[model samples]
Target: MTITEELINKINVCTKCSLHKGRTHAVPGEGSYNAEIMFIGEGPGRDEDLQGKPFVGASGKLLTELIKSIGLSRDDVFIANVVKCRPPENRDPLPEEIAACWPYLDQQVRIIKPLLIVTLGKHSMGRFLPGLKISDVHGQPKRAKGIFNERQVYLPLYHPAVALYDPRKKDILFEDFKKIPLILKQIKKSKNDIQ
Candidate 1:
């Protein structure tokens, strides 16, 4: 089996935390194995849990549009969550839950080796950049050591769900998303220069 397939199989049967007991299915993530970009989110919500897919609800629609705006499709980038299963009543994942699922996410990053990781909420961002507010860092690219590499690049953004509550964040999300391609170009240029 492919490595991703193996990972998914493990996730499917995972009972590492309480979150699994209530989940309809484990969202192991989806998209190109060779993608340059990977999107990490907090966890699966109602729609996503039911469908066993990440970002398939209203927020997902906006995320889809944002990806399209950058001239890429769902097939072009990887999407996964910090927690593979949905928390009870869509509550925040507990610390133990995140810790239990950390190995899986770490394996994914090691496998995909994405040039950029776009964290789509505070929970996901907190894993990489602790002690920072999303408001201060959204749309900005920060380079640091990640689960897989020392030079991983990350871009923090508000969860698309935020726009559902306040429409203003939608415009900001779009603007922030616009920086992706440019940041990717710069990363590639630097890599080439190093070689």
Candidate 2:
């Protein structure tokens, strides 16, 4: 099997943490294996857990629209989560749960080597850029060391779910989404310049 497939298989049967016990299916993420951009979210919700897909609910619909706004489709980017399984009652994943699933996500990053990782919420953002408030940093891109790669680029954004509760956040998210193409272009240019 291909490496990505192997990883997914491992995730599917994972019992590294308590979160596994309640899952209907593990969401190992989806989309292009060779994508330039990877969107990482907090974790699976009820719909995602049942469907075994990332971002397939209402928030997912918004995420889809955001991706389209950038002139790309779900097929063009990778979508994954901090934890493969759903947290109980859609609660935030505990630190221990996140720790248990870290290896899988780390492996994914190494395999995809995406040029940019877009963190879709605080949990995903905290994993990379810890202690930073999403409100203070959303839409700004920063280069930092990731679990596997040095100089990884990350853009933090409020979780799409937030917009559902607050209409003002929806406007902010759209504005932030607009920065993606420019960020990608800048990352590509910088890489070429270095080469």
Candidate 3:
């Protein structure tokens, strides 16, 4: 089996962290194995936990809309979470849980080698661009060295969940979504120029 498939199989039965105890299903993430873009989120929510999929709830709906705005579908990019399992009551994942699960995320990045990584929330952003305020950096592209591969481009976007709680951020999120195509083009041009 492919490394990604093996990793998912392991994750399916993972109990390294206590979060696994409460999980209905481990969302190991899904998308093209050779996608150019990847979207990473914090963790699974209610619908996601129940369905063993990422971004399958209200936030997922908004995420789909945002992806569509950029002329892409859910299948166009890889989508995963920092933590594979849902936290109790949908609370923020504890640092230990994040620590336990990050290697899997790192492996996903290594295998996919996406040209652009769109961090869908602050937690996901912290993985690549640490200590920067998401408020200041939302939609900003940062050159980040990959955990298991070479340097790559990272873009931090507000999690779609934010709009659900506070609709004011929707415009900011939409504006950020609009910037993705241009950003990908620039990355492609730079890569071709180097080659």
Candidate 2: where is the Cα deviation over 4 Å? 191-195
List, residue by residue over 27-92, the lDDT tens digit for candidate 1.
999999899999999999999999999999999999999999999999999999999999988888
CA lDDT, candidate 2, residue 59: 98
lDDT of the candidates, in the order given:
0.92, 0.93, 0.90
Winner by lDDT between candidate 3 and candidate 1? 1
**Stretches of candidate 1 above 4 Å error?**
191-195
Prediction 1 TM-score vs. true:
0.96
- lDDT for 71 (candidate 3): 87
Task: State which candidate, 1 or 3, has the greater TM-score.
Answer: 1
Checking candidate 3 for backbone clashes, the offending pairs are none
For each candidate, give its TM-score against the true structure.
0.96, 0.96, 0.95
The alpha-carbon lDDT assigned to residue 90 of candidate 2 equals 98
**Tens digits of lDDT, candidate 3, 1-195:** 978789999999999999999999999999988899999999999999999999999999999898899888999899999999999999999999999998899888889989889998888898788898999989888886777545678899899999888877998999988988888898988863211
RMSD for each model, in Å, please? 2.3, 2.2, 2.4
Q: What is the lDDT of residue 123 in candidate 2?
A: 97
The deviation in Å at residue 164 for candidate 2 is: 0.8
Encode model 2's per-residue lDDT on 59-112: one tens digit a residue: 999999999998999999999999999999999999999999999999998898
